[model samples]
Target: METFAEVLIILVVLTNLKLLGSSRATACIRTVAAQGVLLAALPLVTSGDAITLRMIAQALVSGTLKAFVLPFLLLRATRGARAGRELAPFVGYTTSILLGVALMPLALALGRKLGVTGPAGADLLAPAALFTLLVGLLIIVCRKQAVTLVVGYLAMENGIYAMGLAFAQREPLLVEMGILLDVFAAVFVMGLVARHIHREFDTLDTDRLSSLKG
Candidate 1:
């Protein structure tokens, strides 16, 4: 169980780097979906031998939304907007990757310093979660596309969900459900706004929004 948790955490960390380095919007979306699948498995590993039906339900919901439903929504939004790769970013792709690499150690150090503990099988969850959050924030700040920002938001939510899974046995099921619902609503609203922005500007690039201030 510990090995499974460690592998999942490592995969999550790699996805974070992939998100930072990827320029193609489709690729970024896929990475986020992959992360979702990984996060969904956390409940099983974290639960160890005491897995419950409620945990299974949560994992199913999380995987479906983060892996399939949310990505489908973003893909539809992307097609409507005619957006693909970001092309150019506020931070270059290579630099962004390097930054992510730098952030890994920092996240670990921070996690250790904070002494945030997790369930038996999820010891590495805190650092992995922190790294994912930072990567998502980087995507939001450094990328220019509205779709990319949406993906970043999802990634950030994944991180939060991962942290929750680390302590799954203690957290209430209702709280997790609420968080999932809120995320769905947020993505729905953001997708609509992104579609509108594309229609109005004829582009999904958010940098173009600066011209609207006149």
Candidate 2:
């Protein structure tokens, strides 16, 4: 089980890097969708004797929203905006990957110091969760486009959700539901803003949104 979670975490992190480096908006969106699906599967893969009805419900809701609904919304937004090329990254692709590599050790050290325990068979979840969180933060900081930024945000949220599954003893269904609702609302607003950006600037590049500079 630990190995499974580790594999999923690695896949998630790789997808984050792909999103950061890819020039095609469509490709980035697809990678985000894939990350969502992998995250959704984590619960089932790590389930042990402690599994409960509430946990299952939480996982279902999370998987449905993060994996299916959120991606569907983003895909629609991408199609509507007709965003093609990725804008210039604040940090280049190679630099971002290097930074990610540098950050991994810090994440591992933090997880080790914290010594978070997961299910009986799944002990590696802590370090993987920490790494995913760090990667998500890097994506948010380095990507300029609104869609890409949202993807980063979602990645971060997924990391948190993964941690909750790994560590939280009790299922916080209400909190989980609230977070999903907030994410949905945020995605709706972002889609509107993306449409407006395309309408006003003729591009989705964040660098190009500085027309009001003093």
Candidate 3:
């Protein structure tokens, strides 16, 4: 179980890097979908022979929503937005990758400071969760694309979900489901806004929206 946790953590970290480096919005969304899938598997890996029906349901619901439903909405929005890749990001791709690399060490230090040993006390798990959360924040702060922002939020939520497991905190199934639905609602609204931007301006760049004034 511990070994599986370590491996899953490494994979999640790699996906974060992938998200940071990729400019194609579709590719970025796909990367986020992969994160959702990995997060869904986390419960089973950490169950440690105590897996229950609730755990299975949570994993299933998380996988269905995060991996499938949400990404589908984002992809549909991206199509409507008619933008292929991020351009004129506040942070360049190279710089974003550097920040991602730097975040891992900082996350490690933070985990140590918090004395988070992780489930089964695995040293890498907690820090990796923090690293993922930071990477998502980096995406949100650095990119101007609306779809990218949604992807970043998903990544951040993924990190938070992972953190709960890393710190051995399990949320009730209803609470988790509600959080997922909230994200879904937010993304649906954001998707509509992105499409509106495209319809009004023929582009999905938020920086351009600054033209809206009193």
Candidate 4:
């Protein structure tokens, strides 16, 4: 079971790297959806039969909504947008990958220092969660597309979810349900805003939305 959790954490981290490096909007959305599925499966991997039915149901809802519905909506919005070019990243691909590589050891060190003791200890969960969180932050900072930012947001949520799974027994099912609900609401609002941005600016570049500056 520990091995399974580690594998899922690796998969999640790899998917985050893909999301960071990929230029195509469709490809990024698909990758984010894949991350969501991995997050949904994470609970199962770490479960110790102490998990309740309500928690299981919450996980299912989170998986379906995050993995399928949210990404589907984002893809549809992407199609509506006129911009088809790869995302204009503030940092080049090679630089971003290098930064991600550099950040890995930092994340591991941070995890070790934090000494987060879960059912599996910090060995599997903490470093991966920290790395994913950093990748999400990098994406949010560098990507100029709203869709890409949303993907980054989802990546951050994935990291949080991974961390939450570490304490799945202590976490209330209602809290998980609320988190999913918040994510759903956020995605819905972002989709609407994406559509509006496409309609108004004739493009989806997030930089352009800042024209109201004084």
Candidate 5:
């Protein structure tokens, strides 16, 4: 169980780095989807047998929504947006990767100082979660593309979901489901807005939106 959890954490961290470095919208969306899939498996790995039939069903629902449903929407939006990549980011890819590398140690140290309560491999969870969260924030702040912002937002939510599992494994099923639903709705709305931007301006670059006077 510990080993499995550790592997998942590592994958999540690697995915975060991949996201930071990626400029292609399609690749970024795919990485976020992979992150969601890993997050879904986290519960089973961290909590040995607290798994009820309901829990299993819940996992399937959350996983399917994050991994498939949401990405499909974003991809559909992208097709209409007609943008292939984030051509210019406020922070360059190299700098973003450097920041991610630096942030990892800080996250690990902070996690240790904060004294996270969980099992053996759980220590890794906090750092990985924090690292991913920061990476996501970086994406949101640095990228100019609307689609990239959506992807980054999902990445942040993924980090939050993973940390929630690590810290509150026994949280009620309803509460977990609620979080997933809220995220689903938020993503849905964001996709619509992205599509609207494309329709209105024929471009998905957020940089252009700033030219609006109102």
Candidate 6:
């Protein structure tokens, strides 16, 4: 179980780097979906030998949304908006990747300093969660398009979900349902706004919004 958790955490870390380095919006969306699938498996490994029905429900619901529903929403939004690559970010792609690489050591050190570990099998979740949060923040600040920002928001949301896994045994199923509902609402709203923005502005670049008079 410990080894499973470690491998899962490492894969999550790799997805973070992939998100930072990827330019094609479709590729980024797929990578985030992959991360969702990995995280959905997280509870099973961390549950040790006494896995519950509730955990299975949570993983199934979470995986369906993260891997399929959310990505499909984003893809539909992208098609509606005619969105493409993340061009003209405030920070360049190369720099973003370099920064992502640099953040790993810092996250690992901070994770250790905090001395927090996930229950039993999930010792490496802390650093991986932190890395994901930082990468999401980086994408949020550096990228210019509304679609990319939505992607970043999802990544940050995933990070928070991962942190919650440290206390998975104690969290109620109701709270998990609430989190999923909130996430779905947020993405739905963001997708609508992005499509509208493109309809009016002819581009998804959020920097174009400053030209609006009202």
Q: How many pairs of residues collide in model 5?
A: 0
TM-score of each: 0.94, 0.87, 0.94, 0.92, 0.93, 0.94
Candidate 1 lDDT tens digits, 1-214:
7888888889999999889989998899999999999989887886678888977888899889888888888887888565877778899999999999999999899777756678776778988988898889889999999999999998888887776665444457787788888888898889888888888899899888875554
Clashing residue pairs, candidate 3? none
Off by over 4 Å in 3: 212-214
Better of 1 and 5 by TM-score: 1
Q: TM-score of predicted model 5? A: 0.93
For each candidate, what is the lDDT?
0.85, 0.74, 0.85, 0.79, 0.85, 0.86
Candidate 4 TM-score, true structure as reference? 0.92
Model 5 misplacement above 4 A: 212-214
* Error of model 4, residue 202, in angstroms: 1.2
Candidate ranking (TM-score, best to worst): 6, 1, 3, 5, 4, 2
Question: What is candidate 2's lDDT per residue for 111-183, written digit by digit as tens?
Answer: 7777777765556567667777777788788877777777777778777766776685645567667878998
Off by over 4 Å in 4: 48-51
lDDT of 4 by residue, 143-201 (tens): 88888888889888888777666554446657667778899899889988988888888
lDDT by residue (tens digit), candidate 5, 1-214: 8888888889999999999999889899999999999988787777786667876887799889988999998998899566787777889999989998998898888767767766556678877787878888989999988989999999999888777765765568788778888998898999999999999889888888776686
Two-way TM-score contest, 5 vs 6, winner: 6
**Native-referenced Cα lDDT, model 2:** 0.74
TM-score of 1: 0.94
Q: Write the per-residue lDDT of candidate 6 for residues 1-214, one digit (tens) a residue.
A: 7888888989999999899988878888899989988998898887788898978888899999999999998888789565768767899889999999999999889877767766786767877888898999999999988888998998898887887775454566787798799999999999889888888888888998885685
- Candidate 1: residue 137 lDDT (0-100): 89
lDDT of 3 by residue, 10-88 (tens): 8999999999999989999989999888978887887688888888888888888878888888888888566788878
